[model samples]
Target: MSKSNTNTRTQTRASLFTPFIAIILPVIIASAVLYRLDPLEPVHFPLDKINRSAITVPLLNKNMRLGSEKAAEGQVLGPEDLVYDAALGVVYTGCEDGWIKRITVNESVVEDWVNTGGRPLGLAFDGNGDLIVADAYKVTGFHIYV
Candidate 1:
């Protein structure tokens, strides 16, 4: 190839990369900013340490297991807390996707009950059978009808 043609091709390739760099740079910066912001801050709670010696209980026939397999439904991202309703037999879990999930306790089936439009932390059932959620972004309580 001629020197002029090679130089032109090099310049074109460099120019093509410029736009990609421009697009990717902002994405990287925004990701850093979002990481700093950490919208799920309220939901992230550290667990209290367990003191084994202080506890006294009768030994059971069943062995204590560490963890259980999550249901076949896609995993719940950033699950903060969970509350169970005895009457309805449903377990509500706060998730990072700005949604609260209702799962059947026996079957481990999950469904998106409601979207809070914000990250939910704690959940409780009121006397009226509505689920009250503590949201991270909003001060008002989120109510979910059963």
Candidate 2:
């Protein structure tokens, strides 16, 4: 091809690529600057707790023997937290099936205590034998729709 035709082709190629670069260059530069400022920055969210570092080493097991055993038997799914009640001689565990179950020491019997109607997370007991549960996705036996 001639010199003028080659120049026109080059300009045509540059024009075709210019709009893409115009749209993409700003995003690339902004992302680079944000990453440079804080590479581990979390996105803007309401309940997102960004931890600085993770504790990987096991704190309780320096030279420990790993042991496992079955604790209970029932439809008790997702026991997130367990609290022992010395008065009843039973261990109460909050489950994801919305039931706080009581199990014996020898994994013999499991009983459904109360159905919270939400997935129970944390469990605690007061001095008056009152059990406290941190139920997720529900408030006061009603599911919160957001």
Candidate 3:
């Protein structure tokens, strides 16, 4: 309506845009600088002589694929590693939430084996059906009594 009032409105609009530009411009400049400084390169590691083992699990039915079929027949929460005990015919998997799960492969059943109080990473079975687990926070051994 008035000249001074129009000027004040323009200044108010500029003040709102100024802070948005100030925040966005620095982020764009920093992203450009970082992109130029550290250009990503394609990494190719040749596995010429790496010794590897292949594990084959018999499917419950002929139509089920190996990886596509669920091992535990339920949702696995952050399973990091798995080990199969041939003697006991059971498979153990380490979980992130301080849990070790036991899955009977033949029966397609899963159950919580033990809680380690820390994130379990690696699992193995020692002699006499004892479960050995490696936790994330510490590298100590855990034996679970079946």
Candidate 4:
């Protein structure tokens, strides 16, 4: 109410707000300048293009439900890639636990085939019955198992 008291209050307010403005104004100005300049020049990859194809894919049946059966008992963890060997009557897959596993198509038999000591991602069989496995992280390359 008094002039001296009002002036003192106004000065205190100004003093308290000045430091915030000093810090905030520089940030606002730098943001504006960086937005204008865009020094980093961000690159966005066409992830959708890389991930999906142009062809129309069939919609999955909504009524489909997963069967209640454990394929391999604890030995196979995180199977990534699969290959079928018609001659051997088996389906082979590479697992994250650094082991190649084979399970029969009928889900009757499961076997541990190979251990790369690294994560295995993909598995394939050549004409000569050589199994090629793509191992990652520690091994970093392909290994052929005969």
- Give the top-scoring candidate (lDDT): 1
lDDT of 3 by residue, 1-146 (tens): 99999999999999999999999999999999999999689977777656567788886777756566567644568899988888678788988888788788888678887888899988777777777787888767787766
In candidate 1, position 143 carries an lDDT of 74
Candidate 1 lDDT over residue span 12-47, tens digit each: 999999999999999999999989898674664455
- Candidate 4 local Cα displacement, residue 120, angstroms: 0.7
Per-residue C-alpha lDDT of model 4 across residues 58-129, encoded as one tens digit per residue? 699655666646666666688899888888788888888787887987755888877888888878887788
For candidate 3, the 10 contiguous residues with the lowest summed lDDT are 66-75
Listed in order, each prediction's TM-score against the native is: 0.51, 0.47, 0.48, 0.48
Model 1 scores a C-alpha lDDT of: 0.84
- The lDDT of model 2 is 0.76
TM-score of 2: 0.47
**Candidate 2 — which pairs collide?**
none
Q: Show model 1 residue runs off by greater than 4 Å.
A: 1-74
TM-score of 3: 0.48
- Per-candidate RMSD vs. true structure? 20.3, 14.0, 14.8, 12.8
Ranking by lDDT: 1, 3, 4, 2
Ranking by TM-score: 1, 4, 3, 2
| Backbone steric clashes in candidate 2, count | 0
